[model samples]
Target: MAGSLLVSLSGITARTLDGCLDLATALDERGVPLSLLVTPNAEEGHRSVSDWVRERVVQGDAVLLHGYDRRVRDEFADLPAHEARLRLIAATAALEDTGLRTNAFAAPGRRVSAGTLKALRLHGFAVYSDGSTVRDLRGDRLLRARLHGFGGRGGAGETARRNAFVLAAARLVRRGELLRIGLRGADLDRPGRWSALLDAVDTALECGVVAATYVGPAPRVTCSPRGSTLTSVPSGARLVNRP
Candidate 1:
């Protein structure tokens, strides 16, 4: 069997959401489905984007809940379970009002709390995102793909990162694991950066991994009701081979 591939674009605030949506459009044209991790409820004066998101989801694409308004902080684990769940619900509810059912949650920096995963599960989300994980909080097998390109300072340094990402991806391919590569909204601002990341995308596809449209029904296993110490998933979810 071949591995699964997941592609994500984070940081979809009001300012960058439109272009990000456009980038997603282009990817769709190429048969590469992109999931946008939208931050619901932008600060004051930001344009309301529910309509855009609604249209995206209507077209058979995914618009997963990103994070809530930057109240206490961007990460959800810092908050209590009640607060975390409520805040997460608010983000999902924003999409719900627009007739979009959210099945996944992606944190701002891929560093949300264990409570973040619980919130995602409680809110009817099956797959959890923001970082690469082989095993979800519910002990379900995840693809464990994370952003492997364009996080460097540029030039030789950036090329080094790109090569490293490709090498790491090659290793994962050999293991029959799911491949997850993340792109940021900022990546759109720099043509060179986004293009560089595309190279890594090509590397994964060439490895015979199939690009997937869905990640799943909230993990079936009962995990920690709160906090971040998640239960073990399958060997496919391990990060030992990643650089």
Candidate 2:
């Protein structure tokens, strides 16, 4: 079997929109689907950016909920189950109102607590990525995915960091594990961060891995509700994301 690749972008506040656009242009026809991790409430003043995101969704890209507030670094990292559910509900509604409906999510830094996962299922999220793995929530199946990309923080010695990322991706591809390429929209603004993401993608393709979205090409598994499943899915139940 061939390895799968999923490319995701986050940190897409107004400040990082330009970088995100640049990276999106570069990824065109690159045989991979892109997932935009968006914060609905945070994008209130950025009408243009929101319009662009809707356009992308129409153009075949997936938009997943990133979090409620971009400034809250650990928004979903350690929330109580009830709290997570509340946030998820509010965030999902905000996205729908903005005309960007989605059923996938990726917590910041991929450091979500177990309670967060529980909330995801209750809220009818079909897929999620916690940095380490991508799970099909309803399907109760998961694929191990290691993220390789930019963090948006420009710094010295980035060449070394870029090289290390490339090397790690190559190793993961060789091992036939899922390749998760995550990038912050702000990375494009950084000196060499955009190129670093491209290099990582190129390397993975060269190693014979096929690119996909968070709704990966993995075989569909039977749906078995572990605890509580969403009693009724919201309208526009399209499943699609990354961390």
> Evaluated with lDDT, which candidate comes out highest?
2
Q: Estimate each model's TM-score.
A: 0.72, 0.83
Tens digit of per-residue lDDT, candidate 2, span 1-243: 445567888777677777777777777757666888888774455777777788777666777788887778888999989999999999887787667777788877658989999999998788887776666788675655557775544468777888788777777677655677888765676666666677778877877776656643342221223322212212222422322
Candidate 1 worst ten-residue window by lDDT? 233-242
Runs off by more than 4 Å, candidate 1: 43-48, 70-72, 134-149, 152-156, 214-243
Colliding pairs, model 1? 110-130, 114-227, 114-228, 126-218, 134-237, 145-180
